[model samples]
Target: MKFTNGYWMNRPEYDVESPMETYDARQDEKKLIAFAPFKRVLTRGDQLNLGATTMTFTSPVENVIGVKLEHFDSENHGPSFKVNNLDPDVAIQIDDNTASLTSGQLKVSLPLRTDFDLKFTVDGKLITESAQKAQGVIFNHDTKVSYMREQLSMGIDEKIYGLGERFGNFVKNGQSIDIWNQDCGTGSEQAYKNIPFYISSNGYGVFVDEPQRVSFEVGSENVDRVQFSTEGQSLQYYVIYGPTPKEVLHRYTQLTGAINLPPAWSFGLWLSTSFTTDYSESTVLKFIDGMKEHHIPLDVFHFDCFWQKGFEWCTLAWDKEMFPDPVGLLEKIHNRGVKVCVWLNPYIAQKSSLFVEAKEKGYLIKRQNGDVWQWDLWQAGNGFVDFTNPDAVAWYQSKLKELLNMGVDCFKTDFGERIPVDDVKFFDGSNPKQEHNYYTLQYNKAVYEAIKDVKGSEEAVVFARSATVGSQSYPVHWGGDCLSNYNSMRDSLRGGLSFLLSGFGFWSHDIGGFEDGADRPTPDLYKRWTQFGLLSSHSRYHGSNVYRVPWNFDEEAVANTKRFVDLKLSLMPYLYTQAAHSAHYGNPLMRPMFLEFSEDPNVFDNSTQYMFGSQLLVAPIFNESGRGHYYLPGGKWTSLLDGKVYSVPLAGQWVDEEYDELSLPVLVRENTILIRNEKADHASYDYTKDVDIHLYQLSDGKVTTKVVDLHGDDVATVTAKRKASKISVNTTGISGSVNVYVHSDNNITSARLVDGVAEIDL
Candidate 1:
């Protein structure tokens, strides 16, 4: 995608036609159009045989500006992203020298009859610009391909992030990234969820409106600009303005899609029958019973790919030999108060009975010819289901409907990343390259709709693997295919943080990594990863060629699993409230430190430590030695586990300490009203009753916190005010009994709700 050899000249084969100046400007009610010829139109004859880059500017949502640069308008086939266009009222004005459009606090200005400078500003302060020679319509003479490129100027210390679940260095300043969804593992540069959107450290974000391949050179090619290009005759992108990072994401999600909060029970511990491991009804029961025997709370039990035969995947049927009575087995698990999730893919292998039927009915993706598209990558002779076909979607959902009727709760929708593009044809005749990443959307949408039909809308969720722009509508995507090691664990977390920052609300990863030989993920690593995984938004234990049962490791692994699982169940009162807020406001459940502490320069590059919600900071111990290193911005922090307080200076402070097998740094911020239920053993229960309201630091101010029920709906509100030696408490919609504590004071202060009010004197 790089057309220039260096800063001075373009490569020899690339004919780069960049706009020099805008000769004329026109305005309609909704849009501003500027015509910029490739060369200086000094003479009247200069405009005869030359082409121009047609620039159009408009607003979809408040404070967001969309820029479309076109060389020649080509016919666009139908599979684009599901962008929400509010079409807010915008101000369009064209004077003699400039054409500018303003929407809310954001404004886009284009100069007239001068050097090309398309600048974006917020409140009259320059954010970024498309400077001279930055917009190009390039034709590679050697390859006979055309591309539209746009380079936005970058600030000196500006950093870029979030190209969708990237596992490399968190700051994406000096990287060449291609937005292509691939099935690469967590340790590679390739990502399963490659989104053509990036958030800037300058408190804004850019989204490339191309489902097809969009390559980005983030200060890598030019060293002072972020260059993004797509192969086609046109390129369209949006610049969303946020004075803060959270506001930027709030607006971004409004344009893409908001998350649907998953059911509360889905947040608990999920134990899976690992891939290629021997598992039957008996084996699954043993693992469930084992968890019970060890005093660990389990919520869901998942069956991996072997649920069906090896080659007959997405028969979407049960392997009779292994699971003779899937219906009864699901009931048995449900009777134990656990849900069931089985793995599924969009590909239907030829060995499956449904494949021939689909091929005959034209339900499978077809080639340029009349034959079905067939491949032999993961399975033998598999064909992708054409989700664009309504009948095909209904047929596929009908198969899942049988399973859902048989007591299956949800599905782990997997393996949509390997979609074939060459000579492929979708039912709706969508562009093949564009349909590659978008196929996951349609596939997951079909399955999600099926589940929502059976269960209610609030009960539907999918553990998806691949995603594009609007996949946030589906909840709970996990980091896929990680190796069993400490490095991979760190990589998984880095990738998960990146994805959350990309507008996803919930995500999870394998407890002890997904890939290793059986009898792997050594006991120490299992114990460490268990703590990290249970603290994630969604917790699941899965592996390849190994059973992720905690008892398979040492006794300490079992103890560690029980410890964290119990802790999560206890904190459901606080966690679910934050989750509901995250879903409603488009803020992430697990966010990077910089998002919360934007004013501190120390947290800009630190992804190792993250804010679990708005109150707690969790630093997972990555090394086997149990030494934890974390930084805290100027405030008082107290460990929830040990009640140790830290008073960090205004300049920020880093702490290095060692932990045991079952402990790490889980700190609460000053003046935080942390609600918990320590004695609870279930994830879904009445959160308003028998709660532990721990007020950290008890700073001399009033703070209010919300309490939500199991359905993620607010049921009550708690307010605490500390005035000198007295801390007064008030509650609404909550009554009866509650225990209160001061975290920095390190003592429990008993309180009873008398007429929805209580007061404790220090």
Candidate 2:
């Protein structure tokens, strides 16, 4: 994707053309287009023979301006375009020399007199602008096509993040990224999910509005500017501006769609039958029973592949030799208060009994030469399902309906990343190259819709692998194919943070690792990863060749998982509210340090730690030392393990703390009230009655409030106001006495409980 060699030279065979001067401008009621030449034009005759270059300026949704530079507009063989949800009678303002368009608070202003004076703003304040020579049309003669490229200003020390589940680095300043989805594991430049949106430290984000591949050079091609380009006739992108990074996400999710809140049980621990391990009903029973005997709470039991016989993936029949009585076994498992998940892919093997029917019904993708596309990668003679066709989608979903009828709760939608691109024809006549990465979206959507139709909308969830821009609507996705080491574990956390910022509500990963034979991790690694996994938005234990039961490693690992799982389930009263907030707004559950502490410069590059929600900070131990070093902003933090309060000064510095296998540094932020469920043996237990509201250190002039779900409504709101010597507590819709803990002030005179409210006097 790089085209430049130095300051003045292009690559050997690539030709780069940039707009140098303006020629003419035209205005209308809804849009403005400007024509510009690649070189300086002295007269009207100079615009005559400007061969093979085009510069255009227009708007898609008002307030968003698109400037495209094209080298060859004659390649008119693109697919039929369709962009929905546009306002045609939008408000627009244009003058003789300049024009401004507004959509909500976002505006794009273009100076007709200048060549590249394109400014983007929010609420009448400038977010960014492209100056002279910052816009260009690039042509690579070797490929006989062109791209639209744009350059924007970047601050000297601004950090960039969120290019979609990236694992290279937390800050994406110096990486060359492509928006093509790949099946590479957690330790590579390739990513399973690639989004063309990036947030900058200056509180703005840009989303390249294309489903096709878009390449980005984040200060790599040019040290001072961030450049992005796509190969097409017209390049369109949206510059979403907010004064804060959180607000930027809010705006971006408004443009795209937000995620739905997954059911409560999906947040609990899921124990899976490892991918290539051979197991029968007896072995599965032993694993589940062992987890219960060791007190490791499990919510969902998943059966990976091999549930169906080999080479007949979509047959939808349970292997009789393995299960013998599939429906009876599922009912027994459900009777134990556990849900069930099964593995499925979109590929239909040639040997499957339904393959001939699919081919005869024209439900498979065909090549231009009139042959069915088949491959031997994961399964022999595997032919993929053509999801672009509605009949084909129903054909695939009908197979899953049978499984749902047999008591399957959810599915592990896997392996849409390996879709074939070249020499294939889709049923909807979409370009195969464009459908390569987007197939996962349609594939997951079909299964998710089926589940929603069968299991009720409140109980639908899928643990998907690959994703596109709007795939966050599917509830839960996991980090795929990692090694069994601490390094992989840390990178997985980083990837989850990136994914969360990409608008995904729930994310999980393999507890130990997925790829290698390091199945039995050292006791230290197992315990540390367990703590980290339990703190994630979703927790699971999955691997490739070996089992992931807690007792398989050590007693400490089992105990550590129990402790954190219990902690997370107890915190459901708080976590569910966070989930509701993320669903209603655009904020995420697992947040990067910079997202919450944008004013603290020390948190800009710290990816080793993150805040689980708004109230607790979790720093996973990545090394075998079992000692963790992290920083806390100026506040009084209390350890959740032991109620010990520590004061941090104004300046931030790394503090060393050691945690055993059963603990990590869970610190309650200052001036916050947290609600916990007293009983957490099951994830779906009642969370209102017997709930404990733990209030942390409250400073002067700080008012804390707690809202618990009262009969499916947030009817009860507890307010605590403190002024100087007395803390007055007021409550509504409650009938029990509230227990209050004063944080080590030593100036308390007396405390009284009055009508379900506690007032402490100092």
Candidate 3:
């Protein structure tokens, strides 16, 4: 996608034409359009042959600007992204030489009569801009049509992040990233989910609103610019402005879509049959029985690919060889208070009976020559289901409807990536190149809609493996296959964080890694990963050839797994409420440190550390020694392991005490009101009764309030305020023991606190 040999020379076959000056500006209602000529027009004769690009600038919603630059305006690509039309909230003022528009806190000013430049200023200071040869149209003779692209300016020290579940480096500064979804595992540069959005450290973000393939060069092709191009004549992108990182996400989610909150039990521990591992009703029963015997909490059980026979993937039939009695097995598994998730893929193998039916009915993707498209990549004669066809979607869902009728609670929708790219045609006549990456969105949408129909809106879920721009609307997604090692574990975390920044609410990874064969993850790695995994939005045990049962590693792995699962169950009141918040608002369940502590510079690029909810901080051990160094933002953090307090002031660092395989680092920030369920036995326990709100390091003069779900009706709000000599407690829908822990510069002589009420004296 890189078209430049250097600054002065273009690639051999591509011709680049950049806008030189603004010829005329037009305004209609609230929309502003700037006509820019590719060549300099100083005279009337210069305007005669104005065969140049036209850049149209408008505001879709407040604080979000959409820029569409078109070389040829005749192409009409249907099935655009679902952008809701909201009334614009910006005021526009245009004059002869200068034009300025304001939306929320974002102001865009253009020097109309001068050089064509775009200045995006938030809070009256320029964060970045599109200057010089930034906006353009490129023509490649090797392709059928010309393309348009936009290159926005970047700061010298700015670090780019996001672009959807990237497994590459955490910072995407000098990388050539294509927003094309592929079924690559966690160890490769290819990503399962490739969103055309990136946020920089300089406080602004650009989201290419196309569901199709959008290529981005983040300071790679051009060191000082972030260039993005599409394969067609028109390129449309949105610049979302945020005064802070959280606000940026707020704006971005408002534009794309917000995620629905997954079910409460879905947040707990999920056990899976390792990929390609032989398992039947007896094997699954033994694993469940063994976990119960070891006191490990397991909420959901998943069946990987081998659940169906090898050549009949989309048959949705239980392999008679392995699971002959799927109905009875499902009933038995559900009888043990566990949910069931079966794996599924979009590809229908030629051997599958459904494939022949689909081919006869024209329900499969076709080539340019109007033949069914087939590939031999993961499976022989694999034909992709054409999600663009409504009848095809219904046919695919009918297959799933049969499984759902047999008590399959959820689905791990895998491999929507690796879609056919060349000479292929969608039923709706969507551009094949555009459909290459956007197909996953349609695939997930169909599956999600089917589950929503069967399980009701709030109960449906998918452990999806691939995604695109608006795929966050689906509930749960997991990190793709990864090797079972410490480095892979770190990369998994980085990938999840990247996805989180891209507006995904829930995500998980295979617990001790996926592809470890001979040199498997040690018991140390299992225990360490168990702690981190259990703290995730969803926890699952999956591997390629090996079993991920805790006992397979060691006794310590079993014990540690039990400990963390129990801890998560104990903290259900906190985690469930956070999950609800994620569903209602688009904030992620697991957040990077910078999302919570945006004002602190130390939290940037701190992938080794993350916030479990709003209060708990977890820093997993990257090495086998279990020694982890992390930054705690200026507070007195109390260890959740032993209740030991450590002071961190003046933006410095802290090292956790030697955390062996049995334990990892967990800290609660100061002034946090930790909410937990009173009972930790059941995943679906009533969170309202006898809940404990443990107050940590209560700083004087600040009001601390926390919210927790009271039954399914109302959320209990608890507020506590501490003054010089007394602390006042108030509650809205809660009646429980509020344990107020006094810490740091407090002179309380006597503490006589009672359940549901408290009074402290100095």
Candidate 4:
């Protein structure tokens, strides 16, 4: 992906052709087209010998400009991300000298009589530009293949964020990232989810419109620009204008797809049967019983890969030897008010009874020779299902439907990253290189649709592993395959925050890590990770070769997990509202500090802590020493756990807070009202009953917060307006009694509300 040996010259066996000057320009009703020669046309003879690159610019929606640079005119490949809701009407003005296309406040200008340049602006102020050899048609001398690349200018001190769930550093500057989906685990630079999108600190976003492997060099190849390239005859990208990072994500997800609100029960604790661990029905029962005995609030229970017999993964049948009556066992779990999620992948082993049926029906991916592709990596003689084929997708979905008929609530769709590309063929005749990354999108979609068909649309959810661009439409994805250590815990947070910037709303990771290096996670690590995991949008306790039952570690671990689980259940009224916001807009449940505090430079690289929802700041304790350093942007932060007040400075100051294993640093922002369900034992409850609305430093202003029900409908709206020492409270569509508490100077002023309105004097 890197083309330059230095700034002076291209690497060996590389030939680059850059646009030099615009020769001609034209405009249609909706778009402007310009032709630019690779070099300056010195004579008429030069025009006859060289071909010109065509550049087309249009507006898909207000404030977004789509640019396509092409070397050869060809029909577009199919399976683009769905953007059916975009506006098509845009205004353009053209003359002999220049062409200007305007979309709302954002405008793109191209000079016709001068050098080849495209400048973007908002309200006549320049944001970014592609000029002076910034757009190039590159060729590899050894392979005789060409690529289209674009380099957009980056301003001084402009930083980059989001490349999809990368476990590296949070800021993407100086990073060479590839949008290739892989199963390289969480320890390396390789990512399971690689989205071809990035938002810059200067308040503009660039999204490469390619399903294939797009390569990006963020301020690496050229320190002054962010260069991205895709191997093809044309490159298509969109420039989205947002003066703020949050608005950027909102528009980005609007162009791609927004996250769906998951079911409310999913917010509670999920206990999984660890991969490669021995878990029969009795073992599952024992774990469930232990959780009840320890008073840990449990919701969903997941059965991992070993649920199917060995070498027969994705058979959709429980191993009878282990689970004698799978339906009965699931019914027992369901009888105890727990949901069941079974693990599945797209791969079908030869030993599976359905493999022959899939091969005969052409439900599997085939090689160029018209034979089913077979490999022996995870399963013996396995073949991947081709979701591109409608029948193949239906066949796979039918198998999952049977499980749902037998009381399965959801599925953990795993291992879509290990797809075959060499000598492979899709039923739709898609480009294999592009399908390598896009396969997960189709794979997860098929399963998600099947669940929606069986369960209602409001109840559909999947715990997916691998993803590419636009896969944020899936409800929840986890940090894949991490070690049970403090470093892995830290890196997982980094990856989740990075993913949040990429538009994924709900994310989770293994509570005590998926796999420990040589042994299981220590009791200290489990206790610490428990606090972090329970705070995630989706919480799950899982591991490999070891049980993740809280009591397995120690009694203290059990108590610690129970405490956090209860706390999370108590906060469901607030958390679920945040989840609904993520589904409606694109704000993530877990947000990097920079997204909220973009003006503070200290938060640009701070990945150790994040904003949980819009009100609370959570700094997870990563080390065993129980010491965490975090920065609080200028505000009056009140500790959510203890009523400790800390006034953060305007310049942003770091605080090193020490705590015992029972708690970490969680602070509530000032001038905010947090709604909590004080009487809920489970996540799915009447959010308006006995609801406690805690007013935190409610400065003289009107603050309104709504509580959404399980179906993402507004059940209640609490409006608080402060005038001097008196605060007026009003509620609409709310039932049951409400308690209003005012937190100031470690004193609580309580008021009981019976009807529509009340007033409290502070």
What is the full ranking by lDDT, best candidate first? 1, 4, 3, 2
Pick by lDDT: which candidate is best? 1
lDDT of 4 by residue, 1-762 (tens): 888889878889888888888777778768888889888777888787676689898887678888989998876655666653477567788888888888878899988757788899999898899987888888998999889889999998999999898999899999999999999888898999999999998998998989888999999999989999999889999998888999888888888888888899999999998998888999999888788888777999999999999999879898999999998999899988899999999999999999999999999999999999999999899999999999999989999999999999999999899888899999999888889999999999999999999998988999999988778887789999999999999999999999889978989999999986565699999999999998889999999888899777788898899889988999998999888976798889888999998888888998999999989899999989999788889978988888788887778688997889898898999888888875677789878777888889888889999989889888789899999999888998667777888876566688987686778898
Tens-place lDDT per residue, model 3, 549-610, is 99988888888998889898888877887777755666788998888887787777788789
The C-alpha stretches of model 1 lying farther than 4 A from their native spots are: 746-748
Candidates in descending TM-score order: 1, 4, 3, 2
Candidates 3 and 4 compared by lDDT, better number: 4
Candidate lDDT values, in order:
0.90, 0.77, 0.81, 0.88
lDDT score, candidate 4 = 0.88
Query: Candidate 2: which stretches are off by over 4 Å?
Result: 51-92, 103-106, 121-126, 702-715, 733-756
Candidate 1, residue 670: Cα displacement in angstroms equals 0.9
Considering lDDT, which of the candidate structures 2 and 4 is the better prediction for this target? 4
Clashes (candidate 3):
1
RMSD of 3: 2.3
The deviation in Å at residue 621 for candidate 2 is: 0.6
- What TM-score would every model get versus the actual structure? 0.99, 0.93, 0.96, 0.98
lDDT of 2 by residue, 1-762 (tens): 688888667898777667675555555655555666677677788667774334444445443345455555544332322333345344456676776666656677766545646777777676777766667677678878867787876777977888899987898898899988988999999999887888888888887776778889988887677788877656666676666888878766666776777788888999989988999888888888887888777899999998989889877789999999999989988887889999988888988987898989888888888688998877888888998889999988888988998999999998788878888988878877678778888899899999999988878899999988778877789999888898899899889888777756678898888875644566677778888888888888888887888777777777788888899898887777677676657778888998889889999888889888888888888888779888887788888777766688877667898776777787888877676765677666555455665666766765655453512236556676777867776666544433555553322133444675777765
